[model samples]
Target: MFEEHGPPIEFTAAGDTPEEQTTNLKIVRPSPGFDPASELCAEAIIKDADVTVLDFSPQQVTVRFQIDGLWHAGTPMDREMGDYMLATLKQLAGVDYRERRERQTGNFASLYLKKKQKFKLVSQGIQTGERVALYLDYKRPPLDKPEDLGMRASMGKQLRAIVNDTNMGILMSTAVPGEGYTAVWRGMLEATDRLTRDFFVMEHVGKNEPEVINVYPVEYDSAKGENPMTPMKQLMLKEPDVLAFPDIASGKLLDQIVSHSVTHEMPIFTRIPGKHCLDGLLRLVALKPDVKKLTDRMTAVISMRLIRLLCEDCKIGFQPHPQMIHQLGLPQGRVAELFKPMVYQPGMVDENDVEIEPCSNCSGIGYRGRTGLFELLMFNDELRQALVSNPRLDQLSAVAKRHGHVSMQMEGVVMIAGGRTSVEELQRVLKS
Candidate 1:
């Protein structure tokens, strides 16, 4: 996967066969006066969009823009114009435009908004046609601190408590695909008070990992049928105080880690792919097959999701109805007005025969930046005992409430009530 990759690329419409999806999609050839550079710039849209996609199906070619972790469809083009556009993008990125059979990835730099930005181009041949995806690496700001990444103040305190604790336990961070798992986990590791403790990171042979000060990395080549347990035995001679397994995912090896290393006052930090923290815990159990080994030493499991922020310059406010608030499960009489994006109309002109201009700040997209929604499932004595007995979603949800744990949706409602985001946007990101 590419660095800061966008969401998954869809070749056809959801729940529709390929033949059915292209029934209404028509490609009108002979695009009049199509200039490759101008067309590429137009599809790239404003400063809000980070990545632009040009996907060619048999029937037509579709353009997509990545905004706030979601993909929005752009203007469609005919096959002839699409071919020219693809070649233009490849030539600009220094990739061979003529070689269409194999996969290719390259980068190109451009001047936009008085900034020199670099873009990555990836072109892969499909069964029907070619699909090219571009990424603007700089658009994604560096989120080193939890507060800057939309983490709640109280939650940040809780995470710091766990990170600074002298006890031995397990710390894990969970997120779905393309939901900033690597960034969140790295931020957690950075938050650690690792100066006094000897921290060692067990990672795969080849991975683009960030270099954290005072933390050393030991590699294991999985391509050669290697595992992390063998390297752990070798590294144990130095007597590491904290072990961070960023990419060692074998359950059997993890069982060895917890059984041998945990009681010696060495805490382990790991990551897993899941929809939420509880989901991650369940997945860990499934991987290890021994619930007691994980529950006894669990410290906390944190999860996160990304949501778009409304542009203050162009966001429109309107009174909310009672039903709308009730449907979103917001507290009654709490929210007065809601915010939404201002879409550009086809003929939005003024009465003075002058065209109405969209907002220049946001380029009429009505959104400028994004913030993350976070949730934490911190373990305590009662919660761990309960999990050991019954490890199920419904049971854990009921028990977690008694422990004063806040869920991701409940945390998102604070943003909706503050008018920083809208109900529709929250629902869209959660459901997506």
Candidate 2:
């Protein structure tokens, strides 16, 4: 009720008389059937009018708004306010959330909302020219901190990696007609990238093709040593004439590969354990120019794997193991902890009177994001010569390990112990 008017606005039956009261509440637009979906989102209720625009055209209207709601502590969505609206539109539009908005700092968020929903303003069908005043509070929500943008960008990259690296193919979560094979090659086209030679960054699988054998099936060779497929070679290498589809003796696929290598310049760097089209392509590449350099490059490619890092938003503190502290050379009185799960008793409270617990970003796993773990096997001239002479892969690995080599498992363990990741994550990624 306004001081001057001194009476509340009233609501009545659709076609009847009205009764009024002296309360502040009023029916601003009783069942008027105005759809904010077409002009703006429900979130427009709490956003800045200037930043949040409602665009109208002859065909459709667009709603653009910002998220300014505070979130619960320790959840990934805690700082992500507009997530609900974006997720809702994603479902209605039948599109992956990735397609909705531009990439924000490491996060994929729709900073400016652009959602469209259609509806009739009234049962009698009011025309577009009719003037309708929407009653609004005319208040604006506060802006988010700039750091939120960084968190978003980081999260987006990891999510993009997960979405792009699914079984279907890189960048392809679905197999739709008219969309080219989404699973492009894993190897990088850039010659300067450290992982340019890795399979995922390069070789793409062709659409509608049968599975070829794995090209690097044998355990990765870190040191040059004795050949592993000699016995099978003796059996299959008898008929050397066939190029594409030669008659292979039973139990002699390696011989066929060897024969193919010898006759057609096929590069069988290492036998891949599984069946995939990349195996055939490896053979094809072996015949190409500079095949040796390419074959040698596989060793470098297998040496690295990537892991995500923990989110700092909920990182806590606690005293680490003495051995770990000593190894890391951390100061005394320093400890490691995370946002505790709900099941346990509360720990000592910090200055803010909040309980210290395991971090929520990593779900108490101590990691929320990932980084690359490289285990290089830098073979010298002697090792290459040893490979030419044909030594076992285990023997090669042994020498590499003795000569300052690091295994992928060791890398994961180191990160876990250092609080960069969790033991569970290390196991999940390394099978340790």
Candidate 3:
């Protein structure tokens, strides 16, 4: 049985310092006859790390934890302990524990720190031994209200107007995986007046099933003779005022969706994977090959990426570097200070006269939460006409910019200037 505790345990990275590494090693190592796997899993949950990967080798087992979208190394274990941990996880996930040479996947729930947490476990055999990945389903607070989604006031107004527009069109949410595109789309759905308009969704799996929206589940199984498009067709027959699907990938499905949007005069909300708004729209055109139909019906494309926000309690303010100011195109003397995730204060010494430690508020991570950086491209008459004729991404992007479409890079720059995040953090996400 899992024990519910007061709060989650905070685990320091093994590579932080030699003394800290030794301390963490002792903490992670299992006691005699006790299961180390369970202890480690519990510790990870308590620490708020949502993902764990364990690699088994002849010599030892390596553990890594994913925190805030980055992976950090954890303490290692001996082969015996590693085997025990793998077997324990397999059993808990209800997979084939005895068959170690095949791939398997399963899900299980546990009570950790007084919360019911779910985990998906996957195991695969390798030449060395086996590799196992455990993905925790960390529940996030609802951002149902559009105001809570961190959009600028002006942008929020525009988005609301677009959503409430009576004309039927296709609205797209675009971002790379893990970029909070789904959350943004869900929030948009919530912004709709559910009491009046009928909203429906089709998805392979569902999360956070809102009461107002009707969701139809779809599964793709060739062996079981399941057609993925059947559920989609069924959902279309209902003729919802607003229809949503998780993604637009298959060419055939994309064509059908476009056709429905045209014939039924209903707005369809879907997502596509892209780094930019124009890139996503271009991909959609490639999928359907009906540029005029898509460009005419498409209303807007919202591109977003989640960036870590600096902890207010411990962030330190500093003057901008000369080059950074120039790179951001800011008037050099006007902007005074920018903030960085600072953990320590001056003259804060330890018993040995060293710096005491990082800020307790952020656990020395320098960031507490994340906020979205959005770039919205709302199509206008000019953009639609340009797309129909040229179908060139560069030309379309120019028109979008002329029509007040902000790029993701510019959004990050604005955030950095406002001291909500640091330039280094922005660079980390943008890789520029």
Candidate 4:
């Protein structure tokens, strides 16, 4: 897949330039006549952060950025400038500028760094003032294959086989929001032969529409008393060979879709929110209340999470720690290589009494990009029989393990052993 699609594009800050690092820095503010709010927005984009939050209060406003799954404090502003910033963003999003006391939501698009970017803005009234959240939809490179999604080669091959199966079944791909679920679904769609088969997708937000795949936008109309299932019914009439629902649906509509997938021998792909494969499956069965039917038509359940990949330019190699090795159940006397981000503390001095500098490659962040940790549960006859009777999550997990299933934790350990990531990173991501 990497050979066919080339390498994944590396994400970079908008105004980032290759230059020498210097201790002297300057803070450049906008001119008196220029808009400070617009400048701040542009700066956020240049930082390449996914989400930004503005906490408004009568005294002042607090800013924060969500970068690499962690939040960092940003520059704060006075009350006057904060109010102006909120008003400017509301105007840009097409929300009612006069109605700041009520909750409102809107979206806008603009060209940033020569790329068209979209953002979702949401605001709600608070005790002291209004709180605003901004979500940036940065454009990502095309994920043309399963391996490109950070899946192990063997797991990717298994997933491809399930996707290509002729028999009718249900394959549930589970992940939290903003954790690469959509990208994985799109890659699975790309693997199918679209020319010979009909493909359809149902989603509320339409983004990154793949070629040769039909998309049906689902929206609700309160004034007209419209039903949300109308669109699903319309798409079902098309007799699609493969149907995908990016979000979980409820009520009789879900039953109809599941029934169709089984009765017509069509493979259906759906997303559920859960941390593990069995948990996702149990949730789906609870919604539909047809355990037999669901288990009978289930082909596989895949659960995944994203972890930061170690920066190759400056990652430091070390021998595995005794505690880490014992936790991973590695055999004693077997040498293993591990890598971690080199951390620098304050007030460190060299032999010449000069302060030490951070690594330029990772900017002291230790990691530069992200990869995925996946757990796949394929339903064989034994597993299906076990699930037919209601079982607890631990029991089901034990059954899967008995069948030689590799979990996300195990996958993370393997990546650590291979020097793809660090133990600290794995613990941070998997932390409750």
Estimate the TM-score for candidate 3.
0.75
Q: List the residue pairs that clash in candidate 3.
A: 8-46
Error of 1 at 140 (Å): 4.1
Q: Write the per-residue lDDT of candidate 4 for residues 332-432, one digit (tens) a residue.
A: 55746779887555576779999977565554566766877888888877777777774577778888889988877788888888888988988887774
Better candidate number, 2 or 3, judged by lDDT: 3
**Per-residue lDDT of 343 in model 3:** 48
Model 1, 1-432: lDDT tens digits are: 112422122112111444543431112112222245334543364545677887888778888888766677777878876787676566655578788878999765555445555667899998878888888666556777778788888888888888878784988888876777877887788788878888998878887587777789888888888876668778889998888887537678777778765657688888888877888888877675456777888889988888888888888899889898887778889888888887666467879978778677665677777888888888877778767788788888878888888877778878887888877888877776
Model 3 regions lying over 4 Å from their true place:
1-39, 78-124, 202-239, 245-260, 331-334, 342-352, 358-361, 389-393
Error of 1 at 371 (Å): 1.6
Candidate 1: pairs in clash:
none
Please list the residue runs of candidate 1 whose C-alpha ends up more than 4 Å from where it truly belongs after superposition. 1-35, 42-47, 57-60, 96-102, 223-225, 323-331, 348-358
RMSD of model 4, in Å? 9.1
Worst 10 residues of 4 by lDDT: 20-29
Question: Which stretches of model 2 miss by more than 4 angstroms?
Answer: 1-91, 94-189, 192-205, 208-301, 317-319, 324-366, 378-399, 413-424
Q: Candidate 3 on 1-432: residue-level lDDT in tens?
A: 234432243222223465754554354334331256667767567446778988888899999987677676777889887776676566556577677779999765566556777778899989988888889886788776656777787887888788777684988888777677666776667666666677776654434445435443444443554333456666666666877766665767777777878888888788788767887877777785567777778888887777889889888899988888899877798779988987454467878888666575664667767887788888899988887787677898788888877777888888888989988888888772
Best by lDDT: 1
lDDT of each: 0.74, 0.31, 0.72, 0.70
Better structure of 1 and 3 per TM-score: 1
